[model samples]
Target: MIEVRRFKKRFGSKEVHRGVSFHVEQGECLGLIGGSGSGKSVLLRSLIGLEKADSGSIVIEGQDITQMTERELIGIRKKVAYAFQGGALFDSMTVFDNLAYPLREHTDLKESDIKKKIRDLLFEFGLADSENLFPGSLSGGMQKRVGLARAIILNPDTILYDEPTAGLDPFNTRKISEMILRLKAKKKTGILVTHDMPVAFEVCDRIALLVHGNLDIIAKPKEIQQDALHPISIFAHGDIT
Candidate 1:
């Protein structure tokens, strides 16, 4: 569903992604594992058109997002949502409003239908009782779940998850993992950039190890464990530190 070919991105003199190429099939979740500053999240941003590639192409469903104007990218953004690492909720708005903002901005759904949609999402993500709560009042896990609820509030075709499980306790991490699996079961495609190995193993169909501006290995989660590449081996065995 998504293809990135020779994606090269640089910030000033720092080149992050150099000739990086990978693809994520429909109904598959690709786990992106890499060290800090490896530009894993840069790929996620590039997919949704938030980040631009200097000298490559990011083709999603046949259209190259790099060439899309802001107006054209609006349509792509609606189909592909980016779930930020820190939840990125609006502190000024209540959870209900935060989730409602997108529906109101992007669609013409009636107030009644929007209310029902928000209610269902909150309940599905286990935040029914906290709809009136603001991001500040929610726990870290609760905030992340609420953020995710807002993300899929549009039923996007694909999700770009940037460090979804970062900083969570084990219990919350499992909850997030289960949530991703539920989405996968529904046939939603995704690119998950995470350092949490267990979460990656649980939800991804294939894991790609990125290092030195390119993907060093791309294989099934179990196959990644047996890969002989140096970076893949250390990352798989948790010896990167």
Candidate 2:
């Protein structure tokens, strides 16, 4: 459902994604793993159109989104959603309002319909009673769940996660990973960029290893384990592969 061809992104003199290329099928959970400064996050942002690539083509569904105008990108963006590392919830807004904001801005749904949608999402993400609470009042895990709810509010065809479980304890990490799987089961094409090896293996249908600004290898977890070229082996076993 997502195809990136020869994607190249740079920040001034530094190149982050050097001729990166990959494709994600519909309803597949693709894990992107890499060490710090490996350009994984930069590629994720570029994939989602948050950071325009210096040179490349990003096509989702069927449209080439890399060079689309902002007006054209709006409708395309509605078909994709991104969950940032920190949840990125508005501290000034309550959970209900936080969920409602996107619906209000993007759709013509009335307030009563938006209320019902928000309530349903709150319950779905296990935040039923916390609708009145602000994000600051929630735990780290709870905040992430809220972020997931918001990301799926529009029922996008693709979801991009940037370190979905970055700052949580182990229990919360598992919870987030399970949520990622569940979201994929619900038929949303998932692109999970995580540093956690166990979580990536547990949730991803396929894994892509990003190293030194290029896509080093892309395979299933078992295939990755068997392939000598897998960059994750170097990451997990210190060049022992």
The best candidate by lDDT is 1
Q: What is the per-residue lDDT of model 2 for residues 1-241, given as tens digits with 9 covering 90 to 100?
A: 9999999988889878899999999999999987787788888877767888889899998888898877888887788898988889999999999899889989999999999999987877778999999999999888998998898899898899999899899988877787788788889898999878778878889898887788858878887678656667667665631
Superposed Cα deviation of residue 196, candidate 1 (Å): 0.4
TM-score of 1: 0.96
Displacement of residue 206 (Cα, Å) in model 2 is: 1.0
The superposed Cα distance between candidate 1 and the true structure at residue 66, in angstroms, equals 0.3
Off by over 4 Å in 1: 226-231, 238-241
- What TM-score number comes out for model 2? 0.93
Colliding pairs, model 1: none
Clashes of 1: 0
TM-score of each: 0.96, 0.93
Question: Poorest 10 consecutive residues of model 2 by lDDT?
Answer: 232-241
Candidate models: Cα lDDT each: 0.89, 0.86
User: Which stretches of candidate 2 lie above 4 Å from their native place?
Assistant: 225-230, 238-241
